[model samples]
Target: MARGFRLIFATSLLLMLLGICNGSTIGICYGRNADDLPTPEKAVELIKNLNINSVRIYDSNIQVLKAFANTGIELMIGIPNSDLLPFSQFQTNADTWLKNNILPYYPATKITYITVGAEVTEAPTNVSAMVVPAMTNVYTALRKAGLHRKIKVSTTHSLGVLSRSYPPSAGAFNSRHAGFLKPLLEFLAEKQSPFLVNTYPYYAYRDSSSNVSLDYALFESSSEVIDPNTGLLYTNMLDAQIDSIYFALMGLNFKTIKIMVTETGWPSKGSPKETAATPENAQTYNTNLIRHVINNTGTPAKPGEELDVYIFSLFNENRKPGLDSERNWGLYYPDQTSVYNIDFSGKGTVDVNTGGNLTTVNGTSWCIASPTASEKDLRNGLDWACGSGNVDCSPIQPSQPCFQPDSLVSHASYAFNSYYQQNGATDIACSFGGTGVNERFQPQVLIVYS
Candidate 1:
């Protein structure tokens, strides 16, 4: 193991002068659909213990808003879709709603954004028409309160709003959503607010063909994918998805508006069919996700950008209807015990109990190129691994023990594994920009004949 280094984050004067230091600002979604959740006060304590200073709630619940007061935690509060029509048609409704839920808590509770509707595109009945007007009314209400400059109004959309996302450069919103999107984009651009999106690479990985791998979705890919059209390199699915949104917005000529990940997570457990949903994968996905966001380089399409990201949930909700995975995305169980340990601080491995004794699971893990990848891809991966990848190739050279009977595939596998092991044998290490994969097989014993 490489010797670990402790990182203390502090903003320097020079950086502030240059620009906003978009550094390490990861938030969590505080969903309360379950009956067994801790009280708002207790949940606040738990969140504080995790050192997460930002939060997003589905509604501006009074108790929650009150509990969060003076905590200095930045909040992104929502107005339920059910209230949109009333808030849209009547300016009085928007004012009254904000007066009741927001005015009393402002400056103390630190409410930063008011998301007018969440994924209204997926609502049971079409409420799309209510979104823009409600946002406008909400802005007016804030403007009336003299808080409009402090608070921004926007709506959340699922990836379904995009008609295409492959290659990322070709990303475009569905024609059916055009009417709703144009005004929304205009509003966001006018307000200098972000385009909120709920991107779940878990779904993309689960539903995709053989092209996308679990490592790719989890930000553990050592392999970076090159978008042919955009000429950008994507290291993981989340960035690809985010860049797709950027491309989609650019297609409409809305270039200045920022993007925020309203929700993104992997479930910790699932039914038999959801094989990818497990505690280890969940921990890996989120742990790496925190590191990725904290690295603060932003997506390939938008470099050096610092943006906020909210992990899907705080606690599992038994009441959420759908597959078991829907209810298992939480970092914590209802009782507040973690399903698996993760450091939001972005400093350690998934299992951070360094003071405790270690137990090794019985198996040998090897990183190799995926058999599913094309031979040309493997060759390309090999060339990169031996070159810029910094892998030693002497073992596969002529007269070496590993040389005879060797083919391009075999040499490539050896090089990929060598690089993977050298880099601590992580999922990211094995990825030759998304081409290499890991394989587990029994150790082989070479026999010699004299």
Candidate 2:
């Protein structure tokens, strides 16, 4: 059984990879703020199964680093904000960190980048001050270890660094942050490393939904916002955000430095006040985002340029502190199940199938409880399918025509199949904690059973 499952998983991954051919590669941020996440080894397997070739972790956990070994997935490891002070104060600290956290893995793990700090500008002034020096020290350590050429070093900045963002051509760094940003930009330009920035259109729209159109935030805007200064027509907020960084760099005469979006995504759920945060909206945002980035049709300011982007996260973090939206940006649930179906390939929507030799199914099918699954798991999955999933369970009610069997398995099978069909009819849609299975069935067959 395990061997069959592995074969199906491998074939599905291969099909996904084929669909992404020659398109822009996308990366995911793997944040581990939730306690329910799977082990690193399992997590790596899930990532591969999804055909994601790149990942960025907040820190270099040894278990995760070991799991990544031999996986051939490109990684961007990070140095947390708390470590910046010590790393900047002493080169020895940086060298020691490298020797312990990075040297042992190296080429085997495919570590391509090391972020010195994440959104350092959002930290205290002193911690923010350490960002550039820490990056310099880390770069020096990599050079001494003969790994400088292989690994690029930099820090991630928030969009807050820009004092003026509208009319992207006029974008400039906030004066208060200039003292730190000036030298940081110089080092990045000199080292030829890319500037990493986290840009979220969700926040912009959340703060002023009345002013910002939902279509603009989700990359579906038909009306354009023309920048008066440069006359560039902006269709989406993300592009404007990216170009603002470019103008800021140009202001400092660092025209040649490249920019990479380190983090960006929409939440699948949110508090009542967060009206725009919904699973459908997240699906639209991410699907459109993949198409936009992979098209390699860069922003209006930088057309036809290849830009690297990493989605904000992989799993919803239950323990993350902030608004409900903070914990809901993940594309997957803790069980590695997709929150909604999405095609990472630039191609059109494709169903996620995990059945060997059955890549595509045309006939009607129904999701039913797997005979081998545990009772507890089935019940839990049934509750979720009927509750949060918003699947209508009316057909399986006690007095309903389909409720004659009056068994947990029977009712659950009906509910599960209903939810699955309402979703994308994909393998993930039927994966209710491994308790559901897809089976081909005719309407007459179900009618006879009824």
Candidate 3:
């Protein structure tokens, strides 16, 4: 029976064990904080022009929901923090909330995730107690409606939730938010819902330019930075930011939960001190980011795993508070003109299959750590391949064919090859902090005999 199961597993892989950790979705955050913005009807037309299929709205305004109906555009609508108290107080309240916002146009509107609140940790008041109950209440309500299995229920948190986010691997949530996050993470794990975070590398780069470079923040870095603790290669700030969140999640012992970027974008304008915020930089960041996510180029820590993201703000909000950047994150001006020219149309390009299985050419290339690198560096590279690289290392396990040689170099070679292949066999995927080298080594499929 065990041998049969192994055969089934390998067969499933050959048949393409993808789509789970593949092809990310790109969505726009349709914030309505501004007064001069177009009507929901007109906004829908603009969204359609972008040709992207997903959108996230801050509220369940009937007009917005109604306008989006039947367009087949997936919507992520939120419940504000103010409502969390009421929603968490009773199952009835959650049911009522959903009844008003969701039940009306859900199937037509294609609502996917119902976020309980927006950045509640950053809310003026500490409604920490209510976050989970609200999610539970909302989830229960969805369950009662037979929609729990269909739509996800969660909350959006800012990067403030993490006390440490550097080096990607050392990511840990603030102990202050630990109590709140523990139950919340559990709830999400049980429901199999995603952990939503408003990830902004702009904030990171803005505050710490010395630590965060312009090229890195805008996804334009020519060279990769190695995470000393994990040895994973981070080419851009966004991936490093997201991977930090992944590491933080891992710290909590919840590894399988998916992460969704509820909000992320660079601003075209900012306070003079926010020097990095320029039209050119904004365009570069978003353009590169859109292509990065849609291309299924997962983070250095989790290659080939899609982290579906929503670009913040479809239109700039004149009414938004704070610094200049707060009001300047839109892809379009209030008049609906392009803030800066960018192509948001091409969503993703990951091919599902390459047809039948085969030998050398079919598998083609392999990746391994450079033998010339120092032993310490080689160890880091190998560690990254087997660790954050998320490669299947069973072939290097005890008694396996590749396991015979035994030493770190051999095992590391096998791991790098697997990680390389799993990640589209790209040159960067082989880059275990610049210590990786690509070679035309063909991989043999794992075979077992009953």
- TM-score top scorer: 3
- Mark the regions of model 3 whose C-alpha exceeds 4 Å error after superposition: 1-21, 346-450
lDDT of 2 by residue, 1-450 (tens): 676655544333322222221124579999999999999998899889878888999999999999999988999999999899899999999999999999998888999999998887787655778889999999999999998878999999999999999889998999988788888988987777889999999999999898889999999999999999988889999999999999888788777677899999999889999999999999999998888886555677765344778997899999998899999999999998999988877752233333433443224555788868888998998899878875545445554334545567766776676576556568999999889888763222111110
Q: List the residue pairs that clash in candidate 1.
A: 220-428, 222-428, 223-431, 223-432, 223-433, 223-434, 224-433
Segments in model 2 whose C-alpha atoms lie over 4 Å from true places: 1-24, 348-450
Clashes of 2: 0
- Cα-lDDT of candidate 1: 0.80
Q: Would you estimate the TM-scores of all the predictions?
A: 0.74, 0.72, 0.78
Error of 3 at 419 (Å): 5.5
Could you list the CA RMSD of all candidates, in the order they appear?
15.7, 19.5, 9.1
Task: Give the Cα RMSD of candidate 3.
Answer: 9.1
- Which candidate model has the greater lDDT, 1 or 3? 1
How much is 256 displaced in model 2, in angstroms?
Answer: 0.6
Q: How do these models rank on TM-score, best leading?
A: 3, 1, 2
Per-residue lDDT of candidate 3, residues 1-450 (tens digit): 898666644433332222222347789999999889999999999999988789999889999999998999999888988888898899999888788878988899999899888787788899988889988999889999999888989889898899998878999999988778899999988777888998888888888898888888888899999999977788898898889899999888887678899899999999988888899988988999889987666787776565799999799998999999999999999888998999975444433333433211124355765768778887887777667876645445564324545556656766676677666678888788777788652344444344
